[model samples]
Each structure stands twice: as C-alpha cells, then as structure tokens.
Target: MNIDISKEDFELAPGESVLIHTNEFIKVPNTLSACIYERYSVKSLGLMISPAHYMNPGYKGNIGLLAVNHSTVPIKLIPGIKICQLALFELTSEPLRPYEKQGGKYMDAKSASISKLHLDAEIQEFLKSKGVQKASDDMAKELGEYLMGHIRASAKRLADILRAEEESQKNG
Candidate 1:
C-alpha cells in the first residue's frame, strides 16, 4: 500500500521502527533534497544513519527510512522527532527517473532493518551452534564484526548506485 505522513508522529521502542517524515514538500517551484547519511541526525545526533536512504523526485509523503537500532543497549524514538533533516534544493530541472522508480532494493522501506547482505550456510550454522543462550564473548565479538562487514559492503554498493543515479540525472 502507499504511505503518507500527516501531522501524527510515532514512538519507537528499543527495537521498534516506523516510517517518518523528511519534512519535505516537493512541488513545481521547489525540489526536496535528501541526504542519505550513515546515521540519524536528530535522536542519535552524532550516530550514523546507514545504507541507502533516499527520496524520489515528485515524492510528497512522509519519507520512509529504515532506522534499525544498531546499539547493544535499548533506545527510544518518538514521533516528530527529527530523525533526519531534509535539505531542500532547486534542481535546474526535474530528474529523468524518479527516486522510487530507480529500481533499488530499498525502494519503499519505512523502518529500521537488518542487513540484507547474503550470508553463507556455514556461517549460519556456526552462529546457530553458538546458540542464543551459549554465545561466548569471542563469539559475540566475532558476530559484531561480521555485521559490520556486511554494513560496509552494503554501503559500498549503495554508493555505487548513488553514483550511477547521479550520473544518469546529469546526462539527461
């Protein structure tokens, strides 16, 4: 279904997430500019927002961004909270392909999420063997590193996509 953000806001429990507004309105006179950063700019402030946050041309809704908690500790998110700030720009012209139609994996994500990176069966087996109840310190540390690796790889892939998109817009 299609999503839109009104005046209502939402609060997120430790691991909870919801779609929020980028506080942008793209109209004929003004274009919305969204910066896909490595972290949330409001609550986490200094923390990084991760992997491929974007806004499409002609988009006019509560911008959906996946804001998965990356901390080991619990965190709270409230509605209308400036999870991020959208910078507005005046594009010389409307882009050829809108953001939603760019055909990326995260076209309409509305909340925080886990890595979509592929993991091997062997690693899954190893992690499973560690078990929720029996994970050792070393295992925990290793898993954290593994997660980081996935994020890094995903970030690189996103960068490639953004670069290509930028080029496409420029060429057209």
Candidate 2:
C-alpha cells in the first residue's frame, strides 16, 4: 500500500473518507506501544485521522490511517507528507503475550485494511453460543433504542439536580 501521494496527491472532497497507509514501516517491541496522532498542521486543514490510534506492543507493519475531510472544500493528501505523528511509550513490564502472538487480524499488515471484527474468534463464539447466525438490523435498532432511553433518563436526572441546586443557591 505504498501510496505515492507525492506523484499524485489523493483528493478528498468534503465529508469524504479514505484509508491511507503510512510511508514508513513501524515495529513495536514487546515492551512498548505507540499512540498515533494527526499532525497539528494536518488537523488545521480540517482533516481528521481515525480515532483508533493506539498500536499495541509487538506490532510490525505500516500504520493505516482512516482519514476524513471535515472542511467545506476538498483537500489534497500529499504522499510522503507527515500527516500523522507517532509517540512510543515503554510499558512497565513486557506482556506475557504480545500482539504478534495474539493471532490478531491486522498483525503484520502491509497495507490499509478494512475491519476484521467479524472474524474475531471470541465474537464468533459468543454468537454461536447465543444461536445468532449473524447480526440483524432489528437487533441494532433495539440496542440503539435501549441506549437512547438510558441517555434520556440520565440527562433528565442531571437537569433536575442542576435545577434543584440553582433554587437552593437562590434561597440561600
């Protein structure tokens, strides 16, 4: 996934998204992890890197970035430009099992990759146990409604507490 952005800058229209691979390959040791951040200058251009920016220890690959253009106009992604910055941190102790040993879907990926969440063994096991062959739209709708109800209730409770505090202050 070597994107020669230098030869032809990738163009992104407003609200468009693209997955781009880093020009550099990265290797994380068993005792270290990396955090990815959009370069401050790149962010100023109204392009946002995906929020999934944490690289686990023992990851070896070119980092993939899911970028979205939030500006009103189109933006150009120049290849070889430092669009993102990575900060590495050493862990207190080496993990018993590192990313390479975990059988993760994206380990040693060389290019931009779509999510392989559906292929996770744990999730598959859960689904099989529950007799769920696949995800359903109805299930998603029900979950959304359930979460929204809780959010509404929490908001109402906060509003009531704030109103009570305001009244108490006025009386005091």
Highest-scoring model, lDDT: 2
On TM-score, the candidate that comes out on top is 2
Per-residue alpha-carbon lDDT of candidate 2 for residues 53-163, written as tens digits (9 for 90 to 100): 888899988888899999999998876667888899999999899999988667877877656665677877888789987645456556656886898799889989999
Q: Would you list the C-alpha lDDT of every candidate in the order shown? A: 0.51, 0.82
Query: Each model's TM-score?
Result: 0.36, 0.70
Instruction: Give the lowest summed-lDDT range of ten residues in model 2.
Output: 135-144
lDDT at position 24, candidate 1 = 45
For model 1, residues 16-99, the per-residue Cα lDDT tens digits are 443343444433222454545443444353333445555555554434465555544555555444555445566777677665
lDDT of 1 at 126: 70
Let me know the TM-score candidate 2 reaches against the reference structure: 0.70
How close to the true structure is residue 63 of candidate 2, measured as C-alpha lDDT? 83
